[model samples]
Target chain A: DAGITQSPRHKVTETGTPVTLRCHQTENHRYMYWYRQDPGHGLRLIHYSYGVKDTDKGEVSDGYSVSRSKTEDFLLTLESATSSQTSVYFCAISSSGGTDTQYFGPGTRLTVL
Target chain B: AQSVTQPDIHITVSEGASLELRCNYSYGATPYLFWYVQSPGQGLQLLLKYFSGDTLVQGIKGFEAEFKRSQSSFNLRKPSVHWSDAAEYFCAVGTTTGNQFYFGTGTSLTVIP
Candidate 1:
């Protein structure tokens, strides 16, 4: 499990509501990432952080934001959740920068009605 | 932009049969390649990765992948398939510029008895 854990393993929310997912890791990895998995989209990067307070948008970062206040925790927020945001969310950590191996967390399944 | 293509959306094979999943990437430079397997409703597990040196990379669970620069491909192969191997497989390409990764849609494997 790579010492990674995601909160709210499964949740159902109403459309237009706010939702936040938490990813916590004990590995002290320098890099952390948020990804979404869908039926035809496979896995798409949502946001990533290289260090505390250092974050960047990914391929599908629109309508979503992230924060990394500490080295062990990265948070993903959907200010206004939409049905399109209903997907499996995964958190990953890497010891180094990109091109390094990433270990993934169990994942959180979110469904927006 | 960078993209990963998994030609086969799904594949079926009998138990104990050889299995191969294709992964092709379009990149200007040599990027790190990886193969991951995800069981139903679970997080992805790293199967193998190719960074440098030998083209053939061995990973956990009796899985291996061949990085063919000539073909711009890194294919995952297993000599014998197990029923437990029936899951979704994803291929990812990582670049050095940023903490970015492009993943293929996925290849759903069905191991029949």
Candidate 2:
């Protein structure tokens, strides 16, 4: 298994509060992605970073932001939490090469009240 | 736009029975396909991927998938089903050049003993 970790394994925040989830990878992968998993909907990409300080928006980037200051750490922040943002968030890392296999972290469960 | 469709939302099968999960994709070109398994409250794990070469691709945990260009499908199959195999399965499609991936809604499998 790839060495990936997600901090704040579980969190509950009231609406309009700020929240940040962290993803750390020991494998030094160049590509890191943040995704949300919800019922009736599969994993949807929220944001991804191709390299340090390089980021891009995904299909569902609204209400979320990401940063990659260092190669090993990627952070996802919700500026203002909403009830629709309540879901399990997963972090994944993969090498820069052609191999598209992504190794995922344990995931963070967030609930907005 | 690239998208994936998993028609079966849920399926039940007896242990030792053959299993199949259907996946259909829509893409302009020959796309990269993948299958992943997710246990309850756990991160997604890659099962198999089809980039090029043989149409039949073998993956971890005794899983295999066949990529059919004519049908635009990448169906997952296993000779025998075990209780451990009961989980949610997602089919993903990606472009050859881009690293972004789109996932299906997923199919929940229940293995009855």
Candidate 3:
């Protein structure tokens, strides 16, 4: 198993509140990704960082933001929580882009009331 | 745009029964495909991936997948399954040059003894 961990495994926040989820990896992988898992929608990419301070938006980037200031840490923030943002978020790491296998962290379950 | 479709939302099978999950993808070029398993409250674990070379790719946990170009399908199969294999399965397609991965809605597997 890859050395990856997500903080705040479970969280509940009221609407219009700010929340931040953290993903930490010991593998020093170059690529890190944030995704949200929802029923009937699978896992949708939120954001990804190729290297320190390099990030890009994914298919479902709205209402979410990410930042990676260091290789080992990637953070996903919900500027203002919404009921629609409630989902299980997963963080993954890969040594290479595209077809390379990605290892995932334990995941964070966030609830917006 | 690249997309993945997993038609079966849920499936139930006997413990010793052979298992197959269907996955079809849409992409302009040869696509990179992958299958991942997710247990309750856990993260996504890579089961198999198809990049190039042999059409049949073997992966962890006694699983295999075949990539068919003509059908635009990459189906997952296992000769025999264990109760531990009961979980949600997702099929994904990777972009040509980015870390982005597009996933299917997912299929929930129920193994009965």
Candidate 4:
């Protein structure tokens, strides 16, 4: 098991509200990623951070934003929640980029009404 | 562009029966492949991964996968099925440079005793 944890394990909120999910890793991994899991679509990458203040968009980066101010914490924020944004979000950490095995966090299930 | 495909949307097998899940990938170069299992309401756990070297890769929980370049496939197999193994499985393809991973739609496994 990796030293990764996600806060607000479960939440439900109305649409058009602001929501932020937090991923914290004690392993001090250099790479952190945010992904959304939906049925029949698998898991889609939302965003990723390689270092502090360095981030990149993923295949499904729309309606979501991420920030990495410290090595241990990466935050994903939905500026305005939408029904389509309801999904289980996962955070993963890797010591090296690509080819290296990534350990995942427990996950956060968010629901937008 | 790199992409992963899981042929079977859902499969059911007897407890003692052998199980195999098909995965095919599309990539220009030698792609990094991985298989992950996710229980209901849980995070994705890495079952195994193939980077290079060995064609057959072994993973945790008595799972193994063979990376066949000729077929562009990385199929997961187990000699005996377990009820606990009933979950969704995802196949992913990644590149050596980009910190990106493309996942398949996922296959749901149902093990019946």
Best candidate (score: DockQ)? 1
Alpha-carbon TM-score of each model against the true structure = 0.98, 0.97, 0.96, 0.98
Computed on C-alphas against the true complex, the DockQ of each candidate is: 0.85, 0.61, 0.80, 0.81
- Model 4 misplaced regions, further than 4 Å: none
* Model 2 spans with C-alpha error above 4 angstroms: A97-99
All candidates' lDDT scores?
0.93, 0.93, 0.93, 0.93
Clashing pairs in model 4? none
Q: Calculate each model's fnat, 2 decimals.
A: 0.79, 0.52, 0.82, 0.80
Cα error of candidate 4 at position B5, Å: 0.2
TM-score of 1: 0.98
| Two-chain DockQ for model 1 | 0.85
Tens digits of per-residue lDDT, candidate 3, A1-113, equal: 99999999999999999999999999989999999988999988999999999999998999999999999999999999999999999999988866688899998999999
Q: Write the per-residue lDDT of candidate 1 for residues A1-113, one digit (tens) a residue.
A: 68999998999999999999999999999999999999988999999999999999999999999999999999999999999999999999998766899999999999999
C-alpha DockQ for predicted model 3: 0.80
Instruction: Output the chain A TM-score of model 1.
Output: 0.97
